[model samples]
Target: MEKLAASSLPMPTTIIADAGFDSEENYVYAVGDEKEPRFEFLIPYGTSVQEQTRKYKKDIQNAKNWTYCEEEDCFLQLKI
Candidate 1:
C-alpha cells in the first residue's frame, strides 16, 4: 500500500473494483477522490445491488445475454 501511495502517481479518476472492496471502510478511504478531481470509483457489491433483471440471471451473466458498450467494455443494463 505504501508503494502505491508514495509513487507520486496520478490516481484514477474513476475506479471499478470488485465486490471485495465494497465495504464501508473502503468507502471512507474513497474520500480521497475529493482531493483528486474525477477520482470516482464504481465498485460492484452484490449485497448493495437491488436492480432486478428480467432477462439476465444474476447467477450467470453471459456476454450474449446482455448488451455491451464499446467504450466501457461491460454489460449495459437496458431499460425496456
Candidate 2:
C-alpha cells in the first residue's frame, strides 16, 4: 500500500487481493482510520479464521455480506 501511494500511478478507488494478503492489520491499513483516506479494499479472510467465526459462517450461508464491484464485474465474498 505504501508502495502504491508512492508510485506515479493514480490511486485505485478499490483494491482486490487474494487470501494470501488477508490479515486484521492489513485490513486496517488499507481501509485506513479517521485520519487517513479510506480506500476500499476487498480481500478474503483466511479460510481457517472464517471457519472459526460463527458470524462469518452465518453471513456466508445467508449470502448477505457480499461486496459487488461493477467495474470488476465480480462479487467479493469477504471484505474489510
Candidate 3:
C-alpha cells in the first residue's frame, strides 16, 4: 500500500465495493499507520452488513486504507 501510495500515479479519492468490505475489522485494518493520509472505505450498493475476513484477495490485499462507497453503479460496455 505504501508503495502504491508513493508511486507516480494519480491517487483515487474514493472506491466502491459490495458487502465484502463493510466490516469493523477490515475498517480497522484499512486504517493506515502514518498520521497524514486519511484513506476512507466505500462499499458498493445493496449490502449493509459488515464482514470480517482473515485476509483480502490477492489482487486487493495491497489496496489498503481505502473507503468504499455503496452508491455507485456499473454497466458493461459490451458483455460477451
Task: Determine which window of 10 residues in candidate 2 has minimal summed lDDT.
Answer: 56-65
* Cα RMSD, model 2: 12.5
Give one clash count per candidate, in the order shown. 2, 0, 11
Q: Tens-digit lDDT track for model 3 on 1-80?
A: 45667999876665555775566655554565563435665754233332233343222434332445556543323211
lDDT per residue (tens digit) for residues 11-65 in model 2: 8888889889988889778757774746878888777556667676557544556
For 1-80, candidate 1 gives per-residue lDDT tens digits of: 33666789965567788878878767667765455533578878765454455444443444444687899878876544
Candidate 2 lDDT score at position 77: 77
Top TM-score hit? 2
Model 2 regions more than 4 Å off = 35-37, 48-80
The numbered model that scores best in lDDT is 2
RMSD of each: 10.8, 12.5, 16.0
Which of candidates 2 and 3 is the stronger one according to lDDT?
2
